[model samples]
Target: MMCNSASGSAAGFLLFTDVDGCLVNKNDYGFAPAVPVLRRLRTEGIPVVLASSKTGCELQHLAEQFELEPAPLICENGGEILWRESDGGNTRTVAGAERSKILRALNGLKPTFQFRSFADLELHGVMAATNLSEAEAIRALDRHSTEPLIWDDAPDRIPVFAEYLQEFGLTLTRGGRFWHVAGNASKGSAMDIVIQHYRSRLTTPVTTIAVGDSPIDQDMLDRADIPIAIPDPEGRFHVQVSSNGHRAGEAGSLGWAETMTRILDDVTGCD
Candidate 1:
């Protein structure tokens, strides 16, 4: 928990965060108590980038909820970047083709297996299955699916799957639900692109901080000057910042907000 020394110095700091496992709760309703800390950072002119596996449509909605004024967004597990225009107009998506290709591949593989997109499967709808464990689904997916598949869970699973793919000279990324199998495109790479976009506007180097809860976030976390992970009940990822073992705390987006607050406190010396 090392806080930044230059807190309140008026320097521009970029905070890159994941949406699903970091900011919003798993249910996608309200943010954790720590969310105000992030809001404080924003008020101080610190830039917070929402790097997530959420779609552009979802991210757009989230940006509104956070009152972010079109901050940089990383979607589809970091395969895409969305940004607001300088004139504060509509948000623009930058990774359409890659996302389409991955979706096309996943759809192509669906006939032989049980695969569905988050958009296609509502959490409490007819398609929702309480009987099926995610692990079982992942095992089935790994055994039968030829195309790369991703089941959302531990952050370590992405690297593990990446390593598994490397054995076959292939690679896969874990997005919200649909696994992405294609050329090299990841959250880390997307974050890099976003950083470059900010770099072009400034003379001083920007300090990058990324927060996430799963293996898919590892690359972005590795790239960040500071990386934080919220607690997971299963203890799958083992991040430095463990929540007070709230077995069923806010899971997805709300968890992200909780972690962001911790990071913001460190970055802004709010403690």
Candidate 2:
């Protein structure tokens, strides 16, 4: 069954967001400041689709927490897109190479690169490395299409390593905590997929607004009709993507709320 546009009209607005530094603060994992704005968006019939480097399992919980169920999720740095099926089951659309193949290629290069992959880090090890609770670590470890790893080799060798990965139809992306290896699919491509999915169902034009605060989010930002960047904890816009020549005034969820509020106001004339 098809869902109608969130706007309850011919036209709609969609929001794509990053998780760690945009909606939830890295230090406290709190999104209280964004709660009001999130409510407002929902009230205004905007679908808040979350696009993140997190796993599907992790995003599932977040989508629930934020009451965004039924919205498509872009997971593992755009390696996969997941959504709830009509029967309450889940459907996944993958865009990148399989995780096993990515791991196989990485293992072949183990002789030259010294890195520790998430698959090798078990639960407790991931907890120690990421400071996440056991449950969070488990959710984070659930991978479908990407492999995140810590590079133990010299920094200068990263470019060479990336080149090597490219030979196997893979690419490396830097994240907040680890470097990720996956197929060439990016957040920009994944967002396009989600947008197209909605467009096929909706009668009116959809306006996309993407928000994030990291280099990994550059692709998503590049794809948005309105790209909003949140400042880092230090109040500096850290994402390398173009924010449509604008930057949020604050950091974390506060900045997220402020920027979205301001942008939505400009876009829809909502107070």
Candidate 3:
């Protein structure tokens, strides 16, 4: 793990965090803990970017709630990278022929899988799965031997659901419970793009800290100088956090906040 020393006054540390599993609980509560922590980071002039499987619309709402200046938002499990308003209102989408090709191939394999584009689903709500329970959906996908993106209401089921999809050459990701099934695009890959963008604009080496909890968060966790998991007891992915707490049930967002504060203190030599 890379720790930023307080002895040197560098530009600032870049804090990359996931939304659903790391900062917000499955029920989307425990947002209070994150608000103050983020406020402190901003007061200290650190950059905190939200990188998640969330769509641009979802991320936009989160950014506003977090009081972020639209730091680079990574959406669709790294399939798209959008520079929030601060980075210029430029939104870079990674979906192109490759994504289209994958969709086409999947469609051919399972016609009843209800293939729909993100835009299409958002605008028309056509082909959306409105009747499937999380477990039922996964079972249905398994029976078909097809990996269809599922939109489950439960947040905790995402990791297991994603793992189950791997057998069918597909994976499940969430941008706030609207399950997204796509190719290998991941949050880590999108974070890489965000890091490179910042690196290009910097003269000094900047430290990157990625924090999340879930299988989808692994990519970003592995890419960070410091990876912090939010202490999910039900999580199948391995993560190392400084501490664990019980404020947010099994969701663990408050635990993540506590871990972040501890890690920052250690890095700053305040401990």
Candidate 4:
């Protein structure tokens, strides 16, 4: 059910977002430009759910900074969740694979493969790779289930890794800068679960809006009632069949706010 937002309209929207390259720049990772839209969303009581390859520590910190607490945030590209203010006590929303299992599978990979997961990257290495401060990188190192990997010079080796992961009932997904390894967890799958949860609580029909920049987000885009594809730093929109939904006016922070602001306006128009 869709409850009225602060606009008093009988419509509620659930926006699931990708944090990197979608909400913030992949290089610098600043979201100042999107602050206004974020504020408006909060004011309207619209739930802004983060679906990212980041860990719960990072997501929780970001959510707290945005005052978006009590909203479950999807992490590790949907392999795990940090449920907030929910009935059930932070259970893994599917993707129940253990961290040890994922690491063990990674160890089984051929030495020729240059794929390095977060588990391999020590704290200092994580800081260097992500450009996050020491504490921030430490938070990022905290993973529950899925493993984010950085594939080096061997692009051809990717398929082989995928094959091995499949044998172990795992899969690989390419995000903006890294690949995510998980079992039966995706942005789309997690969003579906969260959207259904929201619908169960609200009083009106729920409208889901999903936004992202990389191909990693294709499933989420397809699942959204309104899919918005933001351009990359090169200013190219890559989401397949994007014309069927919408492309943002710009890339990164500006595009995120632009598309979100427009959607918020349209929702308010329904009032």
The candidate scoring highest on lDDT is: 2
Q: Could you estimate the TM-score for every candidate?
A: 0.67, 0.91, 0.67, 0.91
Candidate 2 lDDT by residue in tens digits, 97-195: 899999899889999989999988889888888889999999998898999899899999999999999999999988766899999888889999999
lDDT of 1 by residue, 1-271 (tens): 5454453543667888776545755433446554676667667677778876555556666677787745677766655566866576655545424434545555654554454453344333212432224532332222111233435455554565456445543456553334655446678888888889889986667888777776677788778776776555344554443342222234555555565565556456765
Query: How accurate locally is residue 102 in candidate 1, as Cα lDDT from 0 to 100?
Result: 46
User: lDDT of candidate 2 vs native?
Assistant: 0.84
Instruction: Report the C-alpha lDDT of model 3 over 39-70, residue by residue, as the tens digit.
Output: 76765566788876555555666677788765
Write one digit per residue (lDDT tens) for candidate 4, span 19-77: 98888878888888888888878788778899898888898888877666368788888
Every candidate's lDDT: 0.58, 0.84, 0.60, 0.81
What's the lDDT of the predicted structure labeled candidate 4?
A: 0.81
Per-residue lDDT for 7 in model 4?
55
Look at candidate 3 and tell me the lDDT of residue 54: 54
Clash count in backbone of candidate 4: 3
